[model samples]
Target chain A: MATERTRVMGLFDTEGQTASAIRGLRNDGYTLERVHGPIPSHVVADALALPKSRVGWFTLAGGITGFFCGFLLAAFTATRWHLIVGGKPIVALVPFVIVGFEFTILFAVFGNVLGLISQARLPRFGPVTPYDPRLTGHKFGVLASCETARKNDLFRFLEAKGAEIKADEGGQP
Target chain B: MTETALTYQTVDDTVLATLRPPEKSYWIAVALLFAGILMGAGCWLYQILTGIGVGGQNNPVHWGTYLINFVFWVGIAHSGTLISAILHLFRAGWRNPIARAAETMTVFAVCTAGLYPFVHLGRVWMVYYMLPIPSQRTLWPNFTSPLMFDVVAISTYLTVSSLFWYTGMLPDLAIIRDRAKGTRRKIFAILSLGWTGEFEQWRHYTRGYLFFAALATPLVISVHSVVSWDFALGVVPGWHTTIFAPYFVAGAIHSGLAMVITLMIPLRKIFHYEQIITIGVLEMVAKTIVFTGLIVGFAYGTEVFIAWYSHNIVEMETFRWRAFGDYALEYWIMVVCNTVIPLLFLFKGVRTHLKWLFVISIFVNIGMWYERFVIIIGSVAHDFIPHTWGLYRPSLVEFGIMIGSFCLFFFLFVLFVKHLPSVSMTEIKEALPTGGGHGN
Candidate 1:
């Protein structure tokens, strides 16, 4: 049987505290596994050296797709339909622009939504280990994967930095 | 941590706590809204009791104030979603206190706006004919028609926005549920759908909320564009321009933001959310209104320029009539109110001053409504033949229904602020440096 690796999770009561702890942990060669907070904290992200989110890339793609689709709808309707009335031009680019612009915004927004969902990995119905309910109200938690031998050291460091030890539940098999 | 030392200085709490139930001012506003609703009801009743003749709808001017108000309300609905969803997507922190309230306005305004088409139909019962349903009559709604597009667009917006608004309320409802002691607790508990503030639940809720916001963002743009298409798709003189989509959208945001400021000013004062909805937030929103107003003003200018540059006789004549014809007063008022009044917001003092911003917002709303009225009635009233060119006079019923819509919007908003948590508690708490954990 393989020995299970221990992971350390530190819960802080404040964003500033979590941020500083993250920086200190990073400087000491610890890698952060995940962060759970009530809201996003850029400072914490910066400390953890997380990369620029792919959400923006997804949103941009969505927006571009929406824009083109909108343009096509308008262009096709006005030009291809041959709904000529009086002596007016069969396909007018000017009027089509409005519809095109609208579609651009529409598609871009769709991209943003889709990107967020895919990036966030939402709607997982399987049961997972529960976190402290108080985390919803005010807690900021930092989870770190560590070797079994270094677990005690990480715990001691977090405790010295005013972090409360939370559950040591392992990842789902 | 000392409980007494924590600042409980949010303006909403102070104002709401002190607001006596139904004061003279409250009664006056309510009475006015009720009167407008009743008058509209009377107009609707008369239309049902008799026919659709009471509100002047001649040959050319088939659409009247009912459609104008519908477009106007739909435009009004756009701002709330824009402010809530767009701002949220960008991670604008200031929207925390007012997003939910703004969303509520969006939902109610959309509901009111949705009614105009049915009212315009003399036989309101035939509304089902507009739906994409197969019947014994073997009639199908023309999907090509802009009106059908409106039904789809508006319905989509309403459905998505309602979901967005309700999803946002879930967490807050849970808070209320925990706080309540009696029957209210049970009601909140059920409404909360058994939300337990568990980490996994929040994880899903947040993701779900973000997804909905993203979904709602496009609907905001598409809904209004489709509304604009109702006219732009037509070959009618001034209405046939391509600029109508962006022009209409800009105008919608302009008026919508103005209405938001108008509602928030009174609400903040009434509810005492000064700390939560600070002067800074009001100023920020006012600045956005100014930017949108400027875009709308530019669009207005471009439309006039394009009309002349295109050199199309009918289009040119439409522009001429809009500027110097029968409804010149309405046009000028729109120019002055929508374009000029918002220009005052460029001043730092005006933007920061809540009272001034509030007054400006009201004027902006009034101006935008007139702009729609001018666009719809102006083009429709006068067309290719001078012989068919006529005027539209909105009867008392038309006027009543328009005012009634405003009442409906306000009534829903007022009720929402009182019962529901007006501010996003979780979001606001997150903004605090301490993550709001200091309280415990």
Candidate 2:
């Protein structure tokens, strides 16, 4: 026998109300598969208890790389090229320090950007489920995937929390 | 009707309503800017007809007003990027009202700064020689050269900053589009790019914005550092120093923020953004000015110390000449304007008072321009060889061009304010207190 999964979504009148329903479901140990809200709400993330993001760590790594790259470029230009000038030292460490510092900052900033894009899994271009156009304007929704056997219980729980259940028809809800 | 009045009173919507309408002063500013633009164009034509020789560029003093104005414009440009990108990253709410205006200044200032090197070039038509392209003539730009590095750095900075500015304006443009009636609506609709506040769109838009800001913060630092390297990488006594990069960057920010404050004081009054751009924001920016001023002051001290400690007679004499010799008046003026004026900002009363802050900002800008002049022309005027030393004075053409650059800057800013929303409405609305609680 194979376990079956059922997806249920509850539409609420407001962001605050939908957040409450999500919170209630999460407290009862039902994993929230997704959330579609009128606007961004931190409550959904809090209910899910998502782990700390690694974007900062990635930015830090990029910064370090930038610093080293800057240092190397300056060092190489001044020392390896050996462009002697007026009996002054061929490789002046002092002047080259500026380039090194500049490159370090440049690389670090780029790294942070790259990290943010990749980590966010952004530029998403996938098929989106058709939702009420008005939902985006001023409505909130709670979407969750659960065991097929528990569909009736979940429906009852959501209805009890004042969520309006819309029937799924031909893959459209 | 009485109930509605009671609700309005309870809701505290009066503050928004009480915001003064856009006044006649903005029109006067617009007129002045237009005049400036005309003057600048007239001067530029004069420069073109007579040639670069009309301005003050003699032997040994190869760079003059053009380069000084270039650095000044570039320094002024930094404030916008700093306020927009860096403050956004840090989630500084106070940046909401003025970020757009500041970013626009950055773009126009960069455009004006970009013209200087070409104008300085005796053969302006050979400007393409700076680009890395295969041509009939075998003249490849030296990639290692600091001047070449400046070409790359400035172009990159300009490109990135413009992208950042335009992208940031998109959402606000949409707001303006919806609120606008008739022709303005049509214009804004096109600029808004069909933004409908869709969730997925917002997600991508915000992510892209954040990514650009992150990319821009360091680019700002690098661009100025590269500009400093143009001086620092040389064998000149005053120019060749390790500290020049940071010193120049700090000085740039100091001047840039001062310019921003100077512009904003008048704008806030004219645009009726008194409530939005509060005393708190001005104080915060003033603090940044003071901080950068201290860094600049320290760099000055360090330069003197290094000159004396190195025991290089030429270097020591250069420092002496800058401080106590013929240019002593200029040097002391730089110190008084840059260092002493900023010290008044330490007092809360002065910082909070917009009028005082505005006056001080002017002094700071003047001091910063002198600072660049001191570094570039001062060092060149009194170099290692005594017989080669000479004084540089700008001719009428040079003065006209300098004034023209100011006109160009003001012209762009005025047009930007009239056509576009000077304040970021969406960002400002987002920051407004939701339930009558003061937002920190």
Candidate 3:
């Protein structure tokens, strides 16, 4: 399945050009959203006023959880098993730190992966999203949802603003 | 979002071209790697059937070639994470082209390294006993042992490194997905997790990338340190030392950087990605090798000095034996290859010259292997008990398996380069400013 386009999209060569088009679209009362670039661009993000992603919070939470879990696992298991070696303390804090440190990294990585996939709303197998391949390369792209009545005007607006407009119509969501 | 003739499509076309089906040279290389893997697998099977005795390990020198290779490969794995995560954190632009290949190498090297413990075990099937789980007999692995820490650290490092690598590949995979067709397209689509390069997707990806880099940075230091503890925790004459952690970490990065150059020089040549992986990047990597070589050399000096300074008869004797003992040849070779050769990189000409850099890298690689061997077997072979001491020469089985591990690594790498963008398209594109030269 592929994504149905409910909007008009344009491919621009650079971030500045995309920013200008987005500004022009906003002036014309079109809601500006989803600016795409080959790289993460502060210019494009600023133009669209994107929210800062909260992925870091997930990582922090995962790390804290991992620390406690790792420490407790080592401390608890040793006491539970009661297999004393070399007559050392059952809860060896210094040695347990190693396990804790490792698990912190392990769970933080897991959190990062989960955060990326969930926040990105990934693996949408239903349909291909309305997109341009060049958006991930050198071109900066913009997609603006429009009503059927305003579609022609939107295309003309994009074309007049020097965008290489493409009709992104496809599968049902 | 500005206009240029070099658009996203062009970059995609250029990088994806390298992913095309193999030419004759590629085919030959893959075949050779496959043959090496087959020979190694056969040797492993022979060893498994005939017992661990088929290998070179004996009473005194129990940890021989397999353990050395394990350390060697794990050291080789370090550069990938260092290059990818460390440099990314530092925002070093030269790291763009090198990141993907380096991370891939890390994963494959770790996989190769992980196999040795199993191979070294008397009963490979009993490997599950190493895990910390509830058992009918209530047996639990000792967490206090550095060897146990090694198992946890390496496994955690592997998981984190793989995740970091896979996360970074999504954008590139999306590019491939868009360019491919039919089954290939479907495969990439699934692998890419429906990436559309949408604003939200990129936002999450960038944040997640930063988080992964942060998480991986400490791992680069910790994993090798734990591996070092495997020896440091032991009371063996040469192996017992507090400096082992930092020294091992430094050595890991040193050898890993050399391995990266060793792989990338040939890779860029084969893929004709010279423009992307230019001499500048290679020179930068070479410079890093020089820096790391100095640290390793200092550690070596410190090791010898500590041995003598400690005034312990066994420690002093071990230090003396290292340079003038039965394995004197290997010891000197390690010093010359690891420490002395890397000194040539002090000159700009050596760092810039790919051929010279390549030669130096091969030497560093050999030196590192011998360093581990010298540290491991050298100490074990001549313990405090002269009567029990013995030398270990690897049997053909061990040699074959060692060779096979290298082959397996190359095979995976070769397959990765052919199937995916060897040079990261998104990162290289990101590096270039508006209208900048392609893949610089």
Best by lDDT: 3
Native interface contacts kept by each candidate, as a fraction: 0.09, 0.02, 0.65
lDDT string for model 3 (A1-173, tens) is 65333577888776777788888888888766567767777677777777889988888888988988888888876876777778889899888999999988898788778777888888776774466655665667798876667878888888877788866655212
lDDT of 3 by residue, B337-392 (tens): 98899999999998999899899999999999999999999999998988988898
Clashes of each: 13, 3, 12
Compare the candidates by TM-score and give the number of the best one.
3
Q: Summarize candidate 2's per-residue lDDT along B65-124 as a digit string, tens digits.
A: 889999988988998988999999999988876787789989999999998887788577
Q: Identify the runs in model 1 with alpha carbons over 4 angstroms from their true place.
A: A1-12, A15-173, B1-35, B434-437
| Candidate 1 lDDT by residue in tens digits, B39-59 | 777778888878888787777
lDDT of each: 0.73, 0.72, 0.86
For model 1, what is the alpha-carbon lDDT of residue B21?
A: 51
TM-score of each: 0.76, 0.76, 0.95
Best-to-worst TM-score order: 3, 1, 2
Residue B96 lDDT (model 3): 92
Chain A accuracy of model 1 expressed as TM-score? 0.85
lDDT ranking of the models: 3, 1, 2
